[model samples]
Target: MIEVKNIEKSFGGNKILKGISTVFETGKTNLIIGQSGSGKTVLLKSLLGIHTPESGTISFDGRIYSELNPDEKRELRTEIGMVFQGSALFDSMTVAENVGFPLRMFTKDNNKKIQERVDFVLKRVDLTEAHKKLPSEISGGMQKRVAIARAIVNNPKYLFCDEPNSGLDPNTAILIDNLIREITEEYNITTVINTHDMNSVMEIGEKILFLKDGLKAWEGNKEEIFRTDNEAVVAFVYSSNLFKKVREAYLKE
Candidate 1:
């Protein structure tokens, strides 16, 4: 699990996160959602140790990020897996090579062991037959699968995805959401996602954090969203006619 306590961050005197506090539970999909300038991305980066918050603390399991030594911090990074917004696969490398990149960089395991692990993760993501294909030759969905395989190749304790469903059709987006949730449960990893996709919010949002103007305006689960009376949340979540109708039907039921 990850815990954030009153964490605040600023850039050039413009504060992006304002005393945000929340707990991201393990073995579940925790999502950070908000408007474009709401600071979700800044908060996500703070959790990853990429940004130094001026105050408060971020703890993973029991270790406080700010207190870790340099070497210890490096070790902590090895236990993290990140899936970028763009899939971020290398165009020149084959799918298997991309998946095995982390293992080669961080572990001293020989080529044979690396290959075995790569094969296992590829199969886990259902990309067994695409091992030899480069990112340029595969569909966008396939590239995402490859990115997921790479993220998990090291068996990280924490998984962070930045808009994992971005740039995909609705059908493909749902598939990716289900895949991420399944892997989170199967591995019991502390998974956190930064996303603006409402479909993803409803689909796998076991725990949801809603931010507005650099502050945490609300936090709850998928079901609670429909029941929430918070004006900002309602306005943002039901902005579209389709979701408004869905929420109406849910409340009616």
Candidate 2:
């Protein structure tokens, strides 16, 4: 589990996150959703240790991040895995190499050991046949799968995804969402995803945090979101006529 307590961040005169406090439970898909300038990205970056908050503490499973020593911090980072937007795989490397890159960098494992681990993760993600394919040689969905394979190859305890379904078709997006959820449950990894996709929220949102203008406007699950009387969540989530009608139908039921 990851805990953020009174996290406040700013850039020059612009305050991005305002004393936000939340807990992301382990073995569940935790989602952070907000508008363009609502500060979800800033919060995600803070969790990733990219931008340190001026005040507040981020604790990963009870270890205070800011207070960790240099060596301790480095060790903590080794347990983290990140999947950036747009499936940021190395175009020059094959799928097997991409998945094995972390092992090469962080472990003393030999080539045979690395290959065995790579093959295991590839099979886990159902990409056993695409090991020799380069990033450019595969389709978008396959690229994202490759990215996921690489992220988990090192057996990370936490996984962070930024706009994971960004450019994929709806069907493919659903597939990716399901895959992430399944992996989180299977490995009990604390998974946090930053997304603007409402479909994903309703699909895999075990815990949802809704941000508005830097503060947590509301926090709840998919079922609670539908019944929420919070104006901010309602306006942001039911902005479309289709969703509005769906909400109405649910409330009527």
Report the C-alpha lDDT of model 1 over 147-191, residue by residue, as the tens digit: 999999999999999999899988989988999999999999999
lDDT of 2 at 230: 98
* Lowest summed lDDT window (length 10), candidate 2: 120-129
Off by over 4 Å in 1: none
- Candidate 1: residue 229 Cα off by (Å): 0.4
lDDT of 1 at 233: 95
Candidate 2, after superposition: displacement of residue 207 in Å?
0.2
What's model 2's lDDT at 25?
94
lDDT of each: 0.94, 0.95
